[model samples]
Target chain A: MRAWESNIRKVVPYVPGEQPKGDRLIKLNTNENPYPPAPGVAEALKHMDIDRFRKYPDPTASDLVHALAEYYGVGDDQVFVGVGSDDVIAMSFLTFFNSEKPVLFPDVSYSFYKVWADLFAIPYETPALDANFCIHPEDYYRENGGVIFPNPNAPTGLLLSLEAVEDMIRHNQDVVVIVDEAYIDFGGKSALELIKKYENLLVVQTFSKSRSMAGMRIGFAIGHPDLIKALNDVKYSYNSYTMNMPSLILGTETVKDDVYFKETVQKIIDTREWSKTRLTELGFTFPDSMSNFIFASHNRVSAKELFEALKKQQIYVRYFDQPRLSNYLRISIGTREEMEALFAFLEKYLAQ
Target chain B: MRAWESNIRKVVPYVPGEQPKGDRLIKLNTNENPYPPAPGVAEALKHMDIDRFRKYPDPTASDLVHALAEYYGVGDDQVFVGVGSDDVIAMSFLTFFNSEKPVLFPDVSYSFYKVWADLFAIPYETPALDANFCIHPEDYYRENGGVIFPNPNAPTGLLLSLEAVEDMIRHNQDVVVIVDEAYIDFGGKSALELIKKYENLLVVQTFSKSRSMAGMRIGFAIGHPDLIKALNDVKYSYNSYTMNMPSLILGTETVKDDVYFKETVQKIIDTREWSKTRLTELGFTFPDSMSNFIFASHNRVSAKELFEALKKQQIYVRYFDQPRLSNYLRISIGTREEMEALFAFLEKYLAQ
Candidate 1:
């Protein structure tokens, strides 16, 4: 290594899914919403004062926070916003997971968890998930620096009951417990309801998946004011202005149009149900997904072959080459027409 | 303290300039650009397809990065983008300043540098700037973990000669040296040209002051490909999608309008020269500022009294109550008309 290289923080970053530029391909790899954001988001951008670009945005992000608080029926102090859910969770890890004891999560949770832990030098332990890709509440009951896990966990798309989630939180009341609810709006109930009861519990949600504003990069956390304050302290110290002008204005606009928000979510849920039945008919088996995506393994064809075949046809889906996931493919629910196209290709490819 | 609070990364966050919402105020506190961003930025947003909000923006920020690369005449691998210059510098601290040896910077510099050092648990020492608020080249010749300082230092708005900046970088070849050129476009030359000769030198700049996009949240770093790569690794590990779609697209449009960019920078420079004559005539002393703002102290009147007096009239300027800065007020150079309004008030107040 060069002399200067000796002190460099060497890290293997988490590789996000490919965002292929071509519009012709069906993009289901990143679990993005197939629908557009609220019409107000478009209208807000159109009418925005471009002259304001000369001034700095509000570091407190009060406008977006207030809108979120009103929608969720929480106090304004309970809300914290960031560029995206990744930014929120990363900030939480830095702010809360500083103890000597290992932070805890599922072995097969969102891959970014381990990456954050490593980046911050926060010791972490991952207890193995059970055979059915379900988290065991007892596993997180032991000593830890903190706790964080995705609701309706990624790739597996399996969710634990609310009681189990509460059990984990109750056992680890001495440390912060973050329930990342990126997929919660898809089907599962959010832990936001329990924020009043547990001061250490933080519920994180994003506009990326259910709200169809991933490209806009809006995410937020709701918790006791103390926890939110701690996160904001770290956030302000790190970067005072993570949320830009368009995001703050447009995100507030998205929150105002709850009717449109629910409609798009219901459409995705309906498509997910229909896709699940079709996948079963094609000899695929997987966990009952509570997320926008389905993780499936066919009894016949190897997942690698199917992944390559799908890619060759300009269709994109997520496939992890790691243990316990290599044989499965994670497919995000697209529109009915898009799902039909996926199914048509699968039926022909599997028969061959 | 609460049990969970014991492990919280407690910190005193950097307080950014107050972004008071009232449009009636003659704002000149933060040193933001006085003019709006390139006209093409508004045009791009008006014509943008809002349907793309459903997908994640390019994590690589390719279009913006490529635009910046072309403008700077560097390879794409040599450019790095982030939410703002603060984010870029914070990421650099976490990436390049990891050795046991303490990093070095000016004693009185951008306050956020110390906050980041404390936040990341990186050892650092602030060598005092000369009594003139100027960086001494010899002070940075000693062994260190890393080195960083704003080119035209904040609050003081005094700039170091390019030779002095290069001497510091040459002496610290074994460690990374960052030249924060946030106000470079105002008058000073950038250390960016030295990136090819010294691989350890990373030059960071922001569009906030020069290109007029503070509300949009865009900043970039140009350095050797290796340094850029290291910064990117940490950035991705922190948040893959730091640049949202609007920023990516609009920032690119700003870069494409070189004529507008130069015109605005020249306008601010011209305004600064004109304001200096007026301030001197009003019996104030200040460093020979080469930045968009003038940091000045009155010959008789107290800065605190002047700050409050201005605030009462809805004219905002910055006053730091800390050591050496208590008597000084940093007034950003506004439009000719706005500066005349400010002079009108200062003349009446100082005479009284």
Candidate 2:
């Protein structure tokens, strides 16, 4: 209808989770860390020399990549860093898929995959997840240019095991299989180790969730040298200085503080387990989750009604409008006190 | 030869200006601010509540857009903010130029323009600049889908007059014309006022130069509502959270402090004038620049030789390997003291 290209016009666009204003609510809509980043992150930021900002940040976040490589037990050449996991995924779409071949992903997976496909005019096929909302490796055996899926899938919070991931990669030898481990550190195993056997495997992770630096925007992918090179080429051709210096420093330091990372992730996993049991007692039916969030619903209480009730009680949670997810609420696991408040509010609201 | 998409496999990406590490050198290589940012900037950053970072930034950067719109005398809908001007330019390539038609730009202008064209696999033509290294409006009148050039263009620091810009817009009614005003606040007249009259015009600006927030990464574009919509479509489909919270805050405050901005611009202009007169007297053949940098060379001193000599004296300026620009060195205007240091070093180097 406008002067813009038809491909851009056709894009439905991905809508990110709402960021509500006001301090009146206990926010849990987006799956962000409930706790502050490691003390080292703030210390690193506080002492940053303002003069250094005058120079451009390193084009390739070299130090961050090296740190990531060390953490994941990979070579430095196997890593590619970007603004965030979203940027990494977008770059992957640009790098691996072209108009000639179709990219494959789960229909119920990250919504941005479809948006990127439409934006780049890349042909794509969305393989339907099984009836239990789990991706079957056999379903992705078709001739695809590439395959990508969130390890602990958003909105659902279900994780695929390492064996299942290996099966998909083994079946799709020609295509790149990207394991998006945005929330993997919370409970699941990363496919980073699988990269040694599968040349086309790219394991993507973010500091947003585990490191609790979402606002700082840092993410990276570890893969074979060739796969990393493809992503680097795409990134270089697009925007070279994607990650700023402060973010690189923060991310690098956060990765090195293994004590902080392990303690925080364990804390989230413990909270998630406790919350799941409590939700079960409240007559909620939800999938077993491996991420820092839980997806659940009850037949008696509508998802929208519960969301509104929580909002009224100063407790906020995410509710989707899509068909499969419309009746479910995706609640990000918060601190012990915050979860207690949520449970107390839910108990009162349900009794009423 | 790479395992990238065919378009990206052939991409010889643009190399950004050097951002050499360590504090030993007098850095004038990149046209960054010689002075530190507004005092409020660092203070604001220090006091930032790290807790607020858990939530995603406002995807639209609504408050920053509002402030920028107000400063530019336009509606919020007319503005589009991104990570930096580079991101804005990347989005523009997707939004404005279709692969069927060739985009046009000055041959000697910003190198990133061609890089974007190659990345997007869009056909492009480079119109030659005039003998004085200035953009000739008539040269862009050919049948093209879009045209872009930095006002007070980079490397050359030569500016096209506002009237000349209007002439190009008038002649090319059917194509998108992006006027990059990254250096306009330093001295050149802005084409922001022309956006209302010309539906195809998009004026891009950055907070990196005058505002001294290059490390923060914030840039924006102003245009008619429809053109802005096209850019938004592309941005939404690509990466939605391009601008982070700190950047939005830094950019908004920077624009709001009009007095600080004015004083900084005036000081830079004064220093540039003083430096230009000195260069002239010292037998340098420099372009009449409207930018924060000067383009100069001397018959007696080869640009490469001068560059090496300055390096030996622990000074840094940019030298290009491109044909026309090979003989010239682009020197960023620094503080009075820094300029004096540069002059002293130059005098000694030249005498030797």
Per-model RMSD to reference: 0.8, 2.0
lDDT at position B165, candidate 2: 86
In the range A1-352, model 2's lDDT, one tens digit per residue, is 4343332334565666677788767888878898888888778778776655555678878899999889888899999988788888888877777637788889987788889988888888988877678888898888777888899887688988899989988987777788999999988888888898888788899878888878777778999997788788778778777776677777788888899888988998999999999998888989889999999998599999999888887788998888888999999998988999998888877888
> What TM-score fits each model?
0.99, 0.96
- What is the C-alpha local distance difference test score of each model? 0.93, 0.83
Best DockQ among the predictions, by candidate number: 1
Fraction of native contacts (fnat) of each candidate? 0.93, 0.41
Interface RMSD of each: 0.8, 2.8
DockQ of each: 0.89, 0.50
Residue-level lDDT of model 1, residues A175-272, one tens digit each, is 99999999999889888888889999999999999999999999999999999999999998999999999999999999999899999999999999
Best by TM-score: 1
Report the lDDT tens digits of candidate 1 across residue range B1-352. 7899999997986677788889888999998888988999889989989999899999999999999999999999999999999899999999999999999989898989999999998999999978888889899889899999998998788899889999998999999999999999899988888998999999999989999999999999999999999999998898999999999999999999999999989999999999999999999999989999999999999999999999899989998989988999999999999999999999999888
